[model samples]
Target chain A: MPKVTIDNITIDVEEGTTILNAARKIGGRIVPPAMCYYSKLKGSGGKCRTCLVKVAQSSAKDPRPMPKLVASCSTPVQDGMVVQNLTSPEVAEARKGIVEFLLLNHPLDCPVCDQAGECDLQDLSFGYGMEETATEDDRREFPVIDIGDKIKLHMNRCILCYRCVYVADQLTDKRLHGILYRGDVSEISTFIGNAVTNDFSGNMIDVCPVGALTDKTARFKSRVWFLKPMDAHRACGKCPGKVAIWMFGNEIYRVTGRKDQFGEVEEFICNECRFEKKEPGDWVIEGPRHIKRQSVISANHYEEMKKQSIIDPIAGEMNKQE
Target chain B: MKSLTNRSKVVSNKQMTFWERIYFPAILNGMRITFGHLFRRKATVQYPEATREFSDIYRGKHVLKRDDEGRERCTSCGLCAVACPAEAITMVSAERKPGEEHLYREEKYAAVYEINMLRCIFCGDCEEACPKEAIFLTKELVKSEYQREKFIYGKDELVESPDPAKRVDVSKRQTKEVLEFKKDKRYKHNK
Candidate 1:
């Protein structure tokens, strides 16, 4: 085990653990916002530089600080490593720059985007992004394509995170789609427009940080904030049945894998669970899934817990006498 | 006993004098006050016959605004519905098809927008929350109706006329600072 200090909080973690994972172990504000990093998926980090953190001290032996802010997602923790995330102004500036770069080519159509409310990129921008974009050049536009029957891909919004590619490579057996060209002109597209029909391909939509990939069935139906997220599950043979079903009234609007506080899906759900199941009676809803207070999706959403009543002793005695 | 407030009054039932018993003077004083009111400026107007000038920014009936190009400005983001304290607004959104680009401003537009006028407080929160500047509160008041269902305003009632001549003017509701903010080219949304 190696000891790491992140944002002034000390935590002991395994030697092989990345700085991002170590920070996650500490939890709360100390954890850096990662746009491309998916903990569940292997080789899913180092693409998006949004999780840059200042290394104040390298290790116990060599106490020299790193020359530049390092990507927290890829950087491994060393014994007596001192990391600074929110505490460093340099990291904040670098993170803000990273957000700007990520949103450079992004079409700011959040008003029309389904992922506006729960989008990690949207949250990142709101936290670290500037109000105005500096780029005068027109953003690269690509015709919206459906990778699968269930998923809608808007390439203009993609930050080239490659998380979906990882999902296809690791989770799904036969990888149908991958990043097509080279720098700037590069894009995530299927080879010769072949549709991705794999069972685990739907997880790509869940892994996308932005509105690049969206559920086609729930397209333009309602914003994520309007729908209440509930913890729901049903018996399935393929993958774990546990999922989060977004509901509007009694109707289940859309079904997605239950995402953790970091906005990463815990268990990858199959295509059957993701789509083709809309009925309210299909799944047993446990309760309202807890949404963070800062998230816009949690606005006006609350679930009442079990009622506890305390009877006065005198009133109880009088009731007994009666 | 001492009064806590120190402003207590004593009640007495005494015999009246001849002039007091007549009660003519008391009646004459009351008549003078009543007659004086009749000559003063009236506080109210005859609603149907006469009209009062409304404030420029008076929040009354809402208007779903149209852009200068005559396209529907509402993208149906549901910010107005969420910002509404009364929960008066509800809308169903649909993606704009290829030929329907002229009808809507964005790729997605509100297909079935409705506002329950009876539940609306007209606090102008919806107008404030509108990101696209699609919804605004006009000076025109919501009409009274006998049936409860009539109070529920649909897209036909809320959407402003397509003709530029008949467009609802909510410029008064937008302050000078807000107008300037809208005009600022620095912001990407403004551009």
Candidate 2:
């Protein structure tokens, strides 16, 4: 185990653990915001530089600070290494610049985007971005395209985080899509009309940081804030059946993998569980899914009374389903 | 228990004086004051023929605005619906199909928008929440109807007319500072 100090808090972790993961272990505000890094996926970091942190001390032996702010997602921890995330004003200023670059070509279509309320990019820009964009240049535009019949791809809003590419490469059997171009005109596209279809293709929509990819079945139906998220599961052979089902009244609006506090989906669900299971009877309900109080999705949602109930009626129902 | 403060008062059943028992002078005094009001200016005007002046910022009826190009400005983002304390606003948004760009300003448009006028407190939070400068509470009052169902205003009743001359003016409700802010070209929302 190696000892690391992040934002004045000390923690001991395994030698190969990255700075972002070490901060995540401590939890709360100390954790750097990551747009591209997915803990479950390999080689998913260092693309989006939102998680840059200042290294005050390299290690116990060499007490020299790194020359520049390093990407915390890819930088491994050293024994007695001292890191500063929120405590360093240099990192904060650099992060704002990163946010500006990430949003440089991103369209201002959040009002129409399906992933507005729960979007990680939306939260990141809101916290770090300037009120007015300094650039007057026109943003790159692309007509929306359908990836298979289940997902819609809006290339205009992609930050090129490459998380979706990792999902397609790692989870699915045959990867059909990846970053197509280079430099300023790069885009994520399937080789024209060749739909990216597989058992795990739907997981790409969940991993996308922005509204670049969205569930086509739930498109324009309703906003995320208007729906109630319920923890749900069903007996499936392909993958873990656990998922979160967004409902409007009694009708299931959409189904997605249950994301944790850091917005990472721990278990990648199959397309059958993500797209096809859209009925209340398709799975057993397990009460309301917990949402952070600050999130817009939790505006009118409350679960205090549900927590105090004595009877375990839903538990019996879950057993019956199993 | 001791009283919390010194403001408490007691009631008494005391005998009345001769002047109070008579009640004749008291009645005459009341009549004199009542007659004095007959020669003074009236407090109210007749509602049907004569109307009183309303404040410039009076918030009565809501109007869904149209852009200068005559396209509907509401994207149906649900901010107004969530900001509504009374929860009177509800809407269903649909993606703008090809060739329908002239009908809506954004990619999403309110396919169906309704407001329960009876339940609305007219607090103008929806007006404050509209980011597109779409919804505004105008000086025009909501007309009374015979049935409750008629009070639920649909998009037909809420959206302003497309004709330039017939458009409802709500400039009076917006402050000068807000108008100045909206004029800045740096913000994408202004553009």
Chain B TM-score (each prediction, in order): 0.86, 0.91
Give candidate 1's fnat, 2 decimals: 0.92
Go through the candidates in order and give the clash count of each. 0, 0
Superpose all Cα atoms of candidate 2 onto the true structure and report the RMSD in Å to 1 decimal.
Answer: 4.7
Candidate 1 stretches with Cα past 4 Å from truth are A304-322, B1-32, B181-191
Tens-digit lDDT track of model 1 for A1-322: 8999999899999988999999887777778999989999888899889999999999999999999999999999999999999999999988888889998899889999999989988889999999877777778989999987888999999999999999999999999999999999999999888999999899999999999999999998889998899998999999989999999999988999999878899899999998978999999999998776677888888866322313465654343231
Against the hidden true structure, what lDDT does model 2 obtain?
Answer: 0.91
Predicted candidate 2 versus true structure: per-residue lDDT over B25-132, tens digit per residue:
999999999999999999999987998888888888999999888999999999899999999999999999999989999889999999999999999999998878
Q: How far is candidate 1 from the true structure (C-alpha RMSD, Å)?
A: 6.0
Q: What does candidate 2's lDDT look like per residue over A50-131, in tens digits? A: 9999999999999999999999999999999999999999998998999999989998788888999999989998988886
TM-score of chain A of 2: 0.94
What TM-score should be assigned to candidate 2? 0.93
Give the TM-score of chain B in candidate 1.
Answer: 0.86
